[model samples]
Target: MSTLLATGFSAVAADSSSPQELIAKGEYLAIAADCGACHTSPKGGAAMSGGYGIQSPLGTIFASNITPSKVAGIGNYTEQDFARAVRQGINKQGQYLYPAMPYTSYSRITDSDIQALYAYFMHGVAAVDVKAPQTHLPFPFNIRSSMALWNTLFSNNKPFIAEESVSPQVNRGNYLVNALAHCDTCHTPRNALMGQDDSKALSGGSLGSWYAPNITPDKTSGIGSWSGEDLARYLKTGHLAGKAQAAGPMAEAVEHSLQHLSSADIEAMVAYLKQIPAVNTGGSQSRDSYGAASSTEQQMRGDQASAEPGWAVFSGSCANCHQANGEGTSYYPSLFHNSATGADNPTNLVSAILNGVHRNVNGQQVDMPVFGPDANFSMQLTDRQIADVSNYVLTTFGNPKVSVTAAQVQQIREGGPKPLLAQLTTPAVMIGIAAVVLLAAILLGVWVSNRRKKNVARK
Candidate 1:
């Protein structure tokens, strides 16, 4: 593997002191990659054993086993095979991996870093003999062969080329964010084909039920007001005082990935992020700008009106932990000035209510109970009931205009928005439209040519 790496990137050999150094570097790369966060079992299982069920449009797509186990993992993969998988989205068996693996972003990784990552996974990390359950996406998505077409349309696995105009730190930051961290995979919105719309890079995206908000430095819709330290602290702790708190996928990213990253690397990411073009996604207020507590009179006077089902539900169920004024305790997050409740969209808030949230930060466990129908230990809310409570929270504690219907709650509980692929027209219909457009253009060109000829004859 080392010899092969030397052939591709001689710098890898030059930088590496010994096997220990290669392994150490690989570990660092893996931390940046955040592999364990996805590959590890969702049930608090071992790292890299691969049991997480990633919710997608079609269905749940389980992450593959990347551990160095001979049977259940990539233990038998050669260095070239590993490189192809990481950078090219090709498996040892010549299968096209789904874009969920984020090979498009990994494609930008330098060969040297790839070599170190291969070394770490192959030799440094312990081999785990666990086969994650195979993904069984419905119908068209189940066909792995179709992924080849998807890859052709969208995938780009190219090594990072440094721009001479940028500073060394900025270049390094770019590499980390675009390559190692694969931030664009979540932050960048996807087109109809589920390919990233880079035109609006870091301008927020939807991950099924969860929404990954814009991280581009926009003053209202992004992290523009946040200082470098604010970014770093949020990454390290998954909480930033009154500003924001990580939930859903962000929480997992912080708990498993960012917390382990070096302070310098975190700062570098911040530096680069701060410089990206700011794009406002319509909303004009900050995430923490809404849901301020009312006057002391309002706080003291409780509304226990049974006629208002939402208020009644809130008082009956939520007030114990969140308090009557929605001023959460040390264990629970406050509804006032909370990002989830105050965001322009209430997807996260609704999802949290339905699915709940759990995170372990440096052994300090933070968990919120699920109120969905299938929630564990008997804390389930009917569609109407959930809608009512959600509306109550949004209006009283978050935004007055924000509201949810029982129908919407039902849809979110089932699955938020339709997958891009599912939402798009059939391939046959698209092809017909293209053909008609081509025919029209050809006819117009011929007409123009004939008109020019007639004018010449007249002259």
Candidate 2:
């Protein structure tokens, strides 16, 4: 019995390795998990010392400092404790963590990867004593127990299972894209309960001031037109085909995570994304109209339009850009057809119009002229006007169920929009510009020749 115990101890000792190798592996896994994107403060703070605020349907939750600070961070956590927090969404005290941590997806990550991540974060990562801000949840939602109910209905504990029929690479890609990356959490539309509508995976959704575009392989509504090369380029450089670039949450994903991943891993992600079944959530199709808003208009007109101050304000300020028809310009984007306005939650719409969208078109970062006081543009609209306009858009053209207040819009405006505009020209716009320039040059040359001939005759 003593010999057996000695043998077990020897095996455990053999498994333990040098700290440097463990830390290096941990760094790679951390990148794969995109931990820094949320845990690290955006304004150049120490790594893993969280201060970034994540907006959700429930409330605005600030990320906790994962740095090895005993009092302020996860320094006291052991390997098993870290694993539980990451995989099982539990804190060291055994309290359930918010889904905002994306542990529902991370639950499928290999144990080996989780150990490596734990090692790197606890040892290699420098400790910082930054205190995390409390999440500002309204009323009864402030109760952590409510999350348990939310989890019971939506949470799945099962790990990703590889399909026997699919290729090994494809399966690996599927696992990474669906489970580990949790891409669907943002891209897929949600139900009234704010749970992901699995039936409509990768169809597109709005988060804060940004819209996660359709990624499924649908020719008209999704990314069927984008080649594998386009996906790779977008992931690598955050630019694609001069039409779209990664921005908002996606930009963070690219810069902090996807860009650092192996080319093979990226390819696997692309492969998995391509195979995702196309689902049409009937979001905005064109820039003119948000799509169909007859049902929403009918519902809103019957219910509290007169009592809602936002309705009157929206009619006055938003009607010009969005139009009374709610069909906006391609350059402007029609609110009626825009998914951002029509989302199950109105947080993004409130943030976007108040802050305005800054897009990169043809290497030019075109700022969506903001009417808010904070922006250097027109400041005709007050906070109330901004709130009313947002409310009106969501009810009349967007989802009527989701109501936004003036105060919420004010808070989001203070946070600002995600900065990830790419500098590149669209092919169609570039050709048109070139053609006009060539014609102008030819006409100028002809005028010069004619003027010279006339001058000689006069002499």
Candidate 3:
């Protein structure tokens, strides 16, 4: 009986040791999960003491403080409460959290990971007194219960199950991209009800001001042109191939999360992104001409120009580079014919115009001047003018079925563009500028030398 009791006590000790090991493991997992990116305030505000504002189509939702603070954070939450929140999107009171918390993706996280996350937050992380602000939601959406129905339709509770047939690397890539990274949440286009169109996974979608471009392996519409090294470099440095750079939300993602990932993890993300099939939504085909002869002709034909305020704005400001026909230059793509203008979401186009676009050429650089107050090209166009131009482009060049509002344009202007703009410094541009200066100096030197020779000859 004494021996049996001693054995039972030893078993209890071993079981207790598991929690400490779990806590340590959970801390590392939490880093990989990047929980601090959204939950914590910027500039390293009390760690995990959430007070970040997450913008959504519905409204700006403030992240709740998740610190261990008894009064302000998740101090009151039990392990089950934490698990339900992570895996089931339920609060301690059985209320649903918004999908913005990304519990929909976290639902696929392993039970062990969930428990470890709980341990890290509950025991490992420091508590803070920071109070999170209430979300600014309009009307019926303020009610948390509405999320219950949204969850029923959109949320999944199943954890990730690796496939047996695929290579281990591909499986790992799939788990990170689909589950923890939640790439589909942003890249995948949504249906009318806001559920992800699984058929078009990672094809692309328009967030408020910026469009997350298609990331699938389509030869034309997606990243099929990108090599694995190019993808890895872009993920690391936010710029690749002089054609694209990570901006706005993507910039934030890079600064906070992706940059910290292991090289293997980054490669895995690239590999998984490459595997997603390309999908074409078949919205708009080309930039719109608006049936006007030319800018001069449009000016002469006042009736046609006056009918649409948007077209007038575009004619005035954008016609210089984009041309009167909306056919853009070699570097400057024609608005009517380009995929960017014809996307389902006009957010990217509006953001690009309002903020400006600069594409790299051969590791050299060009800059699209920003017309906003923040940049040098500060044009005094009113919010209405901006909206009118954006609407005109969307209707004419983009999908005719969807329409954008002046208010939406105003929001985008105020919200600002993403992928923090790099300073206009490119080697090619620098070299060209240097060459011009050198030529001018040489010409001046020759002229001075000739003048000195003439004076000597006259003397």
Candidate 4:
């Protein structure tokens, strides 16, 4: 398939010569949107035949089947229905979708791209009869109607409007970053109500146990020190050799989305990202500042040597790949000065220890063995053991201030906290707030009526 990088936008030919061409175009758009990351089941399921369980504060919301199966998927949806659902967060049945689907960002996608995505899902993709497990969000979150208010508050249900002032490349980059990539959804901090805190866009946020670090061009906490090529390399390969490496949600993104995008598109994203305002998060050292390790083979092997609990675990299980000194080989990442290890928050390190890293770059798999019992890794680190190792890693090789507790490790091991506000906003609370407002209005109306009656009597 021929990909055109015309006028700074990475797009397929407008006049697709055949159905194959159109399907190809649609496939590219689907890659840009990264539908497969959330839509496809992680357990080797069919494409777009959603069965993946998305962990949120409310509960586990399963990704819905989007394939064009007559009975179980989006076969019934019209182009308008699909477009509306993709852009407005409303389904064909008029049900509101949670922000977990990234509709808030998808809302900014262009009509042409949405049409392409629709074509890909409805035609190019294979249909599966299997139905995804229904999402059962707890309490007020389950009340899908309540999302109407949320949409009104947060969702920008408008198509991309190119900035006349910026260069074509910047506008293209803006469109890709703000709309297709949905970078803000992960990187930007959320408010009390879980809306993206756009004021600090791309300045870092916590995705439960994983921390999405600041991508803004700030010299300290953000990517200010990084060149456009640095950003591009990180996106394309999920690693930047010595500077940074992707793990957690970022690794999944690279594996599923950015790696598939064209070089022009990645460059455009980097361009747009570099132009964003820099935000400082108080750290003085550069992102890759954790000191390198010296040889610890002898220390680790010594029977009489006193090692920390985590060090003992690392020596036994992790040292083979990561090395006794903590400086890993080309395949296994170095612990010192690594992004996963040196992060301000210890979530990603804990998550990496539990979930493990496995991303394919340029046909080579960069794999890490999971330490958690369930995820099919060789080693099963207990909660206490994981905590001990996590704390040791943070203290010795990464940020010493960031320490993990056994309870924290256990919570992350069991899929982190469900969205706190979602759980807190119960049905009773919403009803109570509504009732109070209604009662106040009624009392005001009654008082006004009595006042009007008195005035009439006086007349």
Model 2, 385-436: lDDT tens digits are 8877777676667656667777766756655322221011335555766899
Error of 2 at 361 (Å): 16
lDDT string, candidate 1, 95-136, tens digits: 878777889999998888888889989987778887889987
Those runs of model 2 whose alpha carbons end farther than 4 Å from true positions after fitting are 1-18, 283-373, 377-459
The lDDT, on a scale of 0 to 1, for candidate 2 is 0.67
Better of 2 and 3 by lDDT: 3
lDDT scores of the candidates, listed in order:
0.80, 0.67, 0.68, 0.81
For model 4, residues 316-407, the per-residue Cα lDDT tens digits are 77888987778888888888878777767777888888888888777888888788876544478898999998877777777776788999
Q: Is candidate 1 or 3 superior in lDDT?
A: 1
Question: Residue 114, candidate 2: how far off, in angstroms?
Answer: 0.8
Q: Which candidate should be chosen as best, given lDDT against the real structure?
A: 4
The weakest ten consecutive residues by lDDT in model 4 span 1-10
lDDT of 1 at 238: 86
lDDT: which is higher, 2 or 4?
A: 4
Residue 54 C-alpha lDDT in model 3: 82
| Candidate structures ordered by TM-score, highest first | 4, 1, 3, 2
Q: What is the lDDT of candidate 4?
A: 0.81
True-vs-predicted CA distance for residue 171, candidate 3, Å: 1.2
Using Cα atoms with residue i matched to residue i, what is each candidate's TM-score against the true structure?
A: 0.86, 0.63, 0.65, 0.88
Q: How many backbone clashes does candidate 3 have?
A: 9
